[model samples]
Target: MLSLLDVFTPAAPVWSVDDLIRYSGSPPSTCYRYLKVLCGAGFLARVANGSYVLGPRILELDRTIRLCDPVYVAGTSIAQHLTDSLGYSTLLCILFSDSVMCVQQARSRDAPPQLFNRGQRRPLIAGASAKAILAHLPLHQLRSIYAKNRKDIASGGLGSDWEHFKRALKQIRSDGYCMTVGEYNPGVMSIATGLFNRDGEVLGSLAMVAWAENSDITAFRTLTPEVVRAGQEISARIAATENMMDLPARAIG
Candidate 1:
């Protein structure tokens, strides 16, 4: 059921009971019962055509969670600063168990037409923000995520240039930042760096996205340091939070 929540949350407004049943590997009757219960509890809603969409309750919960999210609280100012300084939209994203979830986003006064918003999800292999987080993930875990999301990769929807992607991740790990162009969206470019807690566990990534027409090598050079600094600042703030105090202990064990 929790898995259902994870799947549905990321895919809200576009999912159906059949998809849920297929994903969960549950019997039709069981899946139907679960969906009925979820709808009754205001977790899922039945649309006009019989498709299921996420209910208003989920939005209320998401709003509350976003407001209280430690990373979002810590990164909001930095994201705004980056947007103001770079004249590009900035985003803060965290890997929520199996998917990368946007927590906060700020658009520059000069943001491009294709700029994305908070709560958007991008493939882990398709964008700089996702690559930044992926670079910090343990090798085994990264491989596992790739294995699980292979279909998205193979369909050319996630920019899965296997060799190129792997090499880029290696470079990101070594350089402490990631950059992408025309991977997720054509004519869109981004640069990102990972944020970590005191224990060095990755907490999230901070990214700056701009139109390709305005983004050149010079722009990358200019934004790289600022992005890295913002990531480091957020990491330090997260490290100081009480919730992160046990991270090191858990890592050690």
Candidate 2:
């Protein structure tokens, strides 16, 4: 059931009943049963053209996550504070699968229009935010991603081969952050640091963006420490929240 729902994306927002059956490789009766269940549960809705789109229930769930999820709650405040203090647009990105999704954004008054917005997904090897998270992933996962996206990795200048790619990510880990210029978008610069869960698993990244014209290489370095600090603070807050949630109800109270 969840697999059917996963077929809907920004690029393919609607699906006909036939489309679902073809994609799922299920018989017509089974597909219809599943679709009926999903529609009844309000996770899918029939559109004017008889295709299905994600229903309003998804919006409700998104709102709940934005309000209650520890990473979103912590990232939102920290991103806004960084934008206000640093005068650059800030992005809070989360890693899911091989993509990084922007979950929170705070725009500075004078900053250039942001290339990424909330809910937009970018390749894991494309930008500073993605690289910051990618650098911390386990070796096995990193190897898998590199094997699948070797061309993109090379084109993005991350590395020409697997060994070089590992070296590049290692450098990011050593520095505690990633910085890039015109990587994802033309003439834009991004500096990002990784956010982690209580077990030190990579959760996402917090990044600040500025126009390259207004930001020099030397100036970009100065901002990395602040962004890295913000990332650490966000990770600490999420860990604290996780710890609280793990406590017994009576103990928490």
Highest-TM-score candidate: 2
Candidate 1's C-alpha runs over 4 A off are: 1-32, 46-53, 145-168, 244-253
Worst 10 residues of 1 by lDDT: 244-253
TM-score, candidate number 2? 0.86
- Give lDDT tens digits, candidate 1, residues 1-253: 6456667654354677678899879999988888888888888888876777777888888887767676787899989988887788998988766657788889876566766667776656667888788777776776676677666655644336556546656788899888777677888788889978777888778988888787676656677888998899988888787753323111100
Which lDDT value does model 2 have at 66? 82
Candidate 2: which pairs clash?
none
In model 2, what lDDT does residue 156 have? 93
138-251 per-residue lDDT for model 2 (tens digits): 888888888889999999988999989999999999999998888988888899999887778888899999887776777867988899999999989988784323211010
Q: Please give the clash total of every predicted structure, in order.
A: 0, 0
C-alpha lDDT of candidate 2 relative to the true structure = 0.85
Top candidate by lDDT: 2
